[model samples]
Target: MRRFAPLALSAAALITTLVQAAPAVAAGSVPGGGHPAGGHRTEVLELVARQTQTTFIDHGDPGTSQGDELVLAGDLLRGPALFGRFGEVCTLTRVGPEPDSFDQQCVGTLTLPGGDLTLQGLVSVTAAGPGEVTVAITGGTGRYRTAHGVIEAVNTSETETRLTLRIIL
Candidate 1:
C-alpha cells in the first residue's frame, strides 16, 4: 500500500493538470464548433422550385369582395428533394382599388434547405405579368439568420414556379 501511494498521487495530479489545461468541449462538438466559422459563416444556396400545390383562401370580406386580397399557400418541388414551401397573405394594394391589375403587399415564409425565410414587401405582378412577381426578403433564421436580398418568382408553367433567390450576407 505504501509503495503504490506515490504512483497513485502522481497519476491523480497529472489528471488534475490535464483537466485544468484542456479546452472546454461542447457536448456534441470537438473543441471548436463542428464548423470552423459556426456563427460567422456566410454562404449562398441557389435552388429552383416548381410549384407542387397552391391554394387561395377566400376571406369573403367586404374590403376583399372583389378578391383584392389573395390568401395563398403552396408547396414547391426541387430535384429529388421536395423542400421549399411558402404561404402568402397578400393584397392588390398598389395601383388598384379594383382587381385584375395591381401589386401586392405580400407577407409569406419560404422554407428553404437551410431554414425558413420570412418574406414581405411589395410583390410586383401587374407590370411583370401573370408569370412573374418580385419580392424582398425581410428576415430569417438558421443559415439565413442575417439574410437580405431579392427573390423573383416566375411561373414557368400552369403548375410550376421558378424561384431565384439572391442572398447577401
Candidate 2:
C-alpha cells in the first residue's frame, strides 16, 4: 500500500501544535481556536509535515515481521512558514500474514520553538493508497509538559503528509 510506504511510525506520528508556551494562558490563551475540554484549557494548531527521510530496519526475517522498525524524519509547517521539525520511531509490535494487516507502536516528537510535544500511538494499516491515522498526545519536554491531545495525519503523497493537532494544556 502506498500509505504504508514510510513514516508508518514517525507519526501515522506529527499532525499538529505550538504557540508561545508563555508561563500561562491568562484564561484568554486559546491559540489557534481552542476551547475548554473537561475543564482543562485547550488549543488547536495546524501543521504540515513533509517526510524527508525514512529508514526501515528489518529484523529477524526476510520480509516484514515482528521486531521490524521504521524511523522517520520530517519538517513541520504552519501554513507556509517553518514551524519546526519532527522525528519518530515505530516498531512492529504485531504483524499479520497479510501485508496490510499490522500494527506499529510509534513514539514521535515535534520539536518547536516553545517546546517539544510528544506523541505515542499504535498505527495500523487497514486500507490501501495514501492513508490516514490518529495518535495520542502523551506528554512533552518544555512548555508542553502538560500537553495532551491527538494527532490526525493524512498521507498526501509517499513523502508528504498533513497533520492536525488538538492540544489540551
* Cα RMSD, model 1: 25.2
Backbone atom clashes (below 3 Å) for every candidate: 0, 1
User: Residues 35-80, candidate 1, lDDT per residue (tens digit)?
Assistant: 4655533333333343333334434443423345554445544444
Best lDDT among the predictions, by candidate number: 2
Candidate 2 lDDT score relative to the true structure: 0.67
Among all candidates shown, the one with the greatest TM-score: 2
Name every residue pair that clashes in candidate 2.
Answer: 15-163
Looking at model 1, residue 62 earns an lDDT score of 35
Q: Global lDDT of each model?
A: 0.44, 0.67
Task: Please list the residue runs of candidate 1 whose C-alpha ends up more than 4 Å from where it truly belongs after superposition.
Answer: 1-67, 95-99, 127-132
Output the TM-score of candidate 2: 0.78
TM-score per candidate, in order?
0.58, 0.78
Candidate 2: worst-modelled 10 consecutive residues by lDDT: 17-26
- The total number of steric clashes, by the backbone 3 Å criterion, in model 1 comes to 0
Residue pairs clashing, model 1: none
